[model samples]
Target chain A: AQTVTQSQPEMSVQEAETVTLSCTYDTSENNYYLFWYKQPPSRQMILVIRQEAYKQQNATENRFSVNFQKAAKSFSLKISDSQLGDTAMYFCAFMKGTGANSKLTFGKGITLSVRP
Target chain B: DVKVTQSSRYLVKRTGEKVFLECVQDMDHENMFWYRQDPGLGLRLIYFSYDVKMKEKGDIPEGYSVSREKKERFSLILESASTNQTSMYLCASRRWYEQYFGPGTRLTVT
Candidate 1:
């Protein structure tokens, strides 16, 4: 079984600044996928970014980027130039690369508030 | 773009009542999933289906059942609603590794 951990329960960032949300997971599988999802006040959950365990390079999507350390099993999301729109609950998820019906194991999310 | 839609945005049901939550995806993804979101628990998978008439139990499948008669529709059923079941329900469809989510249903069981 795989388990994801997000130690921080809440975070606050000033606008135009940078913030990093930390996440870690315990998994025995060699090949897997990591993801960051954001759920705003509207309750619509959207994908922020994703990283593959086999890839050495991190994944970056515009203002969102990920620091994926495969050996350490740490995947943290960095939000550069944070805006008020970035205020939301962020979750970290893990999925194994193998298996046909693989499902996600999510961490207890961290609520991020961006102050103007 | 992938679009996943749920039947309701907010629902209030009495205890012991049978509850049905519907989900539909337009992206034609082979895998669909049902998950529950609590304040601190992020999201926990309840059930998933890879194809029509095929269902698999997730981490928290107890007290819940699912039906997938069609390729794009998946339904989550609560046999007897309880107060503990009062939480946000999310429906998602997967394309390869990325899963697209719907605007979740906030279910309140009284």
Candidate 2:
């Protein structure tokens, strides 16, 4: 079974600063997908970004990006220019690319706090 | 915009009562999932459906069952609610990497 782990339980960042949340996974599959999801206080889960294991280049979405290290089995999320709205619980998820009925295996989560 | 809607935002039930949590998607997505969220424990998948009438058990499938009678609707059934089942339940629909989630239902089983 694949397992995703977010070592940091909570992270704090100053407004306008950058913060990185670390995540690691254990998967034997070569073709898989990694995702970053944000759950705000509103309790709505939102997709932050995604990275494909086969791609060497990291994935970036606006100020949100991921440093996906396939060799180390590490996928970390970087949030730049953090704002108050960026405060949320971030989850790292893993999924297999080959299966049509793939289910995401998620990390425990990292609660990010953006302080002004 | 894609939307996944849960039938109730909050629910309270007795321990022995049968509980049903309903979810509906507007994007006509082929995949729908039910997950329970607990503090510090993250989200644990209970069940998922790839197509109507087809279901699969997830990592934590014990004590939970799912029904997907229609393409847009997915329902989670708890045979008999227990205090341990109290948690925030999130519903999602997706085709690939991006998943659209509905506002979760906070269920309290007493």
Candidate 3:
């Protein structure tokens, strides 16, 4: 069984500042997918960003990006110029296969607070 | 653009009651999942359905069961609700990479 771990239980950052959330996983599969999901107070889980283990270039989506180190089993999410809307619980998820049938393993989560 | 809807936003039931939490997806997705979220525990998959009428037990299926008579609808059932079963239940549907989620149903068993 693969496990995703987010060591931080809570994190806070000033608005417009940069913040990084750390995540690590245990998996034997070489080709895999990683994701960062945000759950706001409304409780809807939204996809923030994703990374493919095979890609060394890292993934960038606007101000959201990932530092994926497959060799170290680490996948971290970095949010730049953080805003108030970014306050939410962030989850790190792992997937080993493609398509709808693939199962996802998620970390406990880190609650991020963006202070004004 | 993708929509996943749950039957209720909040539900309170008595212990030993047969509890049903319904979920419906609009994308006609082939895969549906039920997960329970708790404080500091993240989300634990209860069940997943890949096709109509086909169900698979996930990590935490001991006190839960699932039904999927149609491709768009997946239901989670608690045979006998217990106090320990109180938590927020989230439903999701996916066609390939991204999973679209519903506004979860918060269920409480007294």
TM-score of each: 0.98, 0.97, 0.98
Over A19-106, each residue of candidate 1 has an lDDT whose tens digit, in order, gives: 9999999999999999999999877899999999999999999999999998899999999999999999999999997355988899
Instruction: State the fraction of real interface contacts model 2 keeps.
Output: 0.84
Positional deviation of residue A30's Cα in model 3 after best superposition, in angstroms: 1.4
Report interface Cα RMSD per prediction.
1.6, 1.6, 1.4
Best by lDDT: 1
lDDT-sorted candidate list, best first: 1, 3, 2
Clash counts for all predictions:
0, 0, 0
**TM-score: model 2, chain A:** 0.96
- List pairs with backbone clashes in candidate 3: none
What's the C-alpha lDDT at position A38 in model 1? 96
Q: What does the lDDT come to for candidate 2?
A: 0.93
Least lDDT summed over 10 consecutive residues: which range in candidate 2 chain A? A95-104
Better of 1 and 3 by lDDT: 1
The C-alpha stretches of model 1 lying farther than 4 A from their native spots are none
Query: What does the lDDT read for residue A41 in candidate 1?
Result: 89
Worst 10 residues of 1 chain B by lDDT: B93-102
lDDT of 2 at A48: 90
lDDT per residue (tens digit) for residues B1-110 in model 1: 88999999999999999999999999888899999999877899999999899999998999999999999999999999999999999999996897999999999999
Candidate 1, residue A22: CA error in Å?
A: 0.2
Q: Write the per-residue lDDT of candidate 2 for residues B20-101, one digit (tens) a residue.
A: 9999999989999999999999999999999999999887899999999999999999999999999999999988767889
Once fitted onto the true fold, the runs of candidate 2 whose alpha carbons sit more than 4 angstroms away are none
